[model samples]
Target: MNTFHPQYLNDSQGNTISVVIPLAEYEQIVKQLDELEGIRLHVNTHTGKRPSIPLDEFVRQRMAFSKPIPPAHNGEPIGSPLL
Candidate 1:
């Protein structure tokens, strides 16, 4: 296992304010988080319907669902309110 010591920065009041970790460790953590996110998304997609179907049925159903849908509201531009 790779272990590292983190350095701390203190404020004028002599209290620890922040910590600094190695860049390699930070990159590794980020990579792990990304992998976890991918796994979570995959699981969520598969579990969208319970009692997951067999490989063949799943492929067929996925193909059916992958079909293109009609454009929205006569192709009018839609604005994102949250943006």
Candidate 2:
């Protein structure tokens, strides 16, 4: 449970119309809400147990997809192999 010193605005009929909270409290609430949303997204996106990848296959796929490039600090051209 949480407690706060809430301030309220009333309409002409003395009905509660709006409420105000401290800026720090408001920021804390926003941060909590963002965290809750992230948790909900994670729950919704995962359907089953994660698939496992073998180390040998992972290394082979990685090597096939990647290429070695010259370092940028040497002012070498990109994509083309250095002589």
Candidate 3:
């Protein structure tokens, strides 16, 4: 079993830092945080391990992005490519 006492502090900016968490609330929060961290790490690892796209593929993707998507969807430049 663990115990925690609620407390509060004010910094130099006079901002109030309230500490009203009960022990049960703190435990719940910590458990949720551990789960969240695991999820974040999993997502980051998956992203990091994604296969690298070749340079030619990258250039082709960029060129396709730069061209005005024909609005003939309605005829107008969808967006300015530069900047």
Among the numbered candidates, top lDDT falls to 2
Q: What is the TM-score of each candidate against the true structure?
A: 0.51, 0.53, 0.39
Superposition-based RMSD of candidate 1 using all C-alpha atoms, in angstroms: 12.2
Per-residue CA lDDT of candidate 2, range 1-75, in tens?
556778999999999999999988888889889999887767666965444579787777777777787578778
**Model 3 agreement with the true structure over 1-83: per-residue lDDT tens digits:** 54567677777898987667777879987998999988887887888854467978877777877755667566666675441
Flag regions of model 1 displaced more than 4 Å.
49-83
Best by TM-score: 2
Tell me which residue pairs clash in candidate 1. Answer: none
- Candidate 2 regions exceeding 4 Å error are 48-83
| Model 1 agreement with the true structure over 20-83: per-residue lDDT tens digits | 9999989988988999988887888798934556888877776666644445688854543221
What TM-score would you give candidate 1 relative to the actual structure? Answer: 0.51
| Deviation from native of the Cα of residue 39 in model 1, angstroms | 1.0
Screening candidate 3 with a backbone cut-off below 3 angstroms (N, C-alpha, C), the clashing residue pairs are 71-74
